[model samples]
Target: MFFSCKPAEMANLMEDEVFMAFTTYAAIVILKMMLMAPLTAYYRITRGSYANEEDVSRKSAEEKKKLLKAHPDVERARRCHQNDLENVIPFMLIGLLYALTGPELSAALLHFRLFAGCRIFHTISYITVLPQPSRGLSWILGMLVTFSMAYRVLSTVLLL
Candidate 1:
């Protein structure tokens, strides 16, 4: 019975590790949101509203007629938020898997680091509007890391 519980305990530890990683990721996400808040505020101030997409599009058109320059910072903020939305799911999945199947601590750490690095690179590349290849590569790396964690979890389940 003790032996049987070992894996469960390890799995729990791994889950904790993953949770910590996710907490770090969440902090960065929050930072990104905070960074964008000012831009959003500016957009609202200049445009008289905070609605996005079709609403912003219509407002922007009307504002242009009135000779107000589009808020470039607000646009940047929108893009940053969009990028976060795109990558967050994969990060969460990987973290969850890590928690459930604590793989080698070093390997898991490496994967987490790589994923976080790639996310940062991806965001920078996006903000700078890097070449398609560079941005694509970063995104691919992030996905690969996430998939690796998932595979590890699935294999652990299979072994059980």
Candidate 2:
């Protein structure tokens, strides 16, 4: 048996509802993460803070020096993006493996939806400077969802 599923079985698994839900939520979170780059740029442009020489190439030396200073808004957007990189990439990889583990559709949807929702909430809280527990809670909850999926994947695979 190949991963305990024959080729025909694997083909059917590809069409599984649980796997489809995983892909949809995975795409949502991935797109949300990608948008952070533009959000960071928006903050940088509006706040007159440029991180690189190329970003301020047209400006005079004095202007360049002024633009080079860090802005809290830009930093917040960047940190959110960075956090996405740390969290979402693992979710994608582990999610793919988890989907292949033949989990129930409802259980997989709960995992996928919670993760996507938490990430979106995290971005919103970070950008709007929402109070402490909001951002922290979103991060913790999202991480928990990913970890839960990972545990499921491990348990399922180990059984084989």
Candidate 3:
């Protein structure tokens, strides 16, 4: 009994506002990342671009060759999705540890919201072919937020 909290105490932990906020933002970013696959497919289908020969098997040989080439828009979508993989995975891992560290709810929410917002903006800027600094700034800001959360986790936890 000494090692375990009571059920009500466990419920309290589950209800923690910081953790709750983290979960909400985590799910939002994750869902957004997941949707990038379909978005990429949509871009490919609309643009007649396919990476694999098999994907254009139904077309004429010459058509297949043309379809297999990369389109600029498709490449943009693909790169945006790839960038999401890089940034979001780190946010999920570090955000979990950061949540467990019991940061102030407001501060945690700010971090989570900023990251999510920045990511969404990053995708829009990339896909819409916004000017250079738009996408670049969003990416850097989101990365900074993740780094901030990581710093909090490292500072709060006991070092090995």
Per residue, candidate 3 scores C-alpha lDDT tens digits across 34-137 of 99999999999999899998898889998987898999999999999999999999999999889888899999999999999999999999999999899999
Question: How accurate locally is residue 140 in candidate 1, as Cα lDDT from 0 to 100?
Answer: 93
- Tell me which residue pairs clash in candidate 3: none
Clashes of each: 2, 0, 0
Model 1: lDDT of residue 26: 52
**What TM-score does structure 3 among the candidates reach?**
0.92
C-alpha lDDT score of every prediction, in listed order: 0.66, 0.92, 0.92
**Pairs that collide, model 2:** none
lDDT of 1 by residue, 1-160 (tens): 2125587776665457555665676566546545655756665567555444544564566674444445555565577667766776666755665655656657867777777788777767766678889878988998888888788777777655
Q: Candidate 3 — worst ten consecutive residues by lDDT sum?
A: 1-10
As for lDDT, the candidate ahead, 1 or 3, is 3
Ranked by TM-score, the better of candidates 1 and 2 is 2
Q: Compose the digit string of candidate 2's lDDT tens values, residues 9-107.
A: 878877889878988999999999999999999999899999999999999999999999899999999999999999999999999899888788889
- Candidate 2 lDDT trough over 10 residues, lowest sum: 1-10
Off by over 4 Å in 3: 1-10
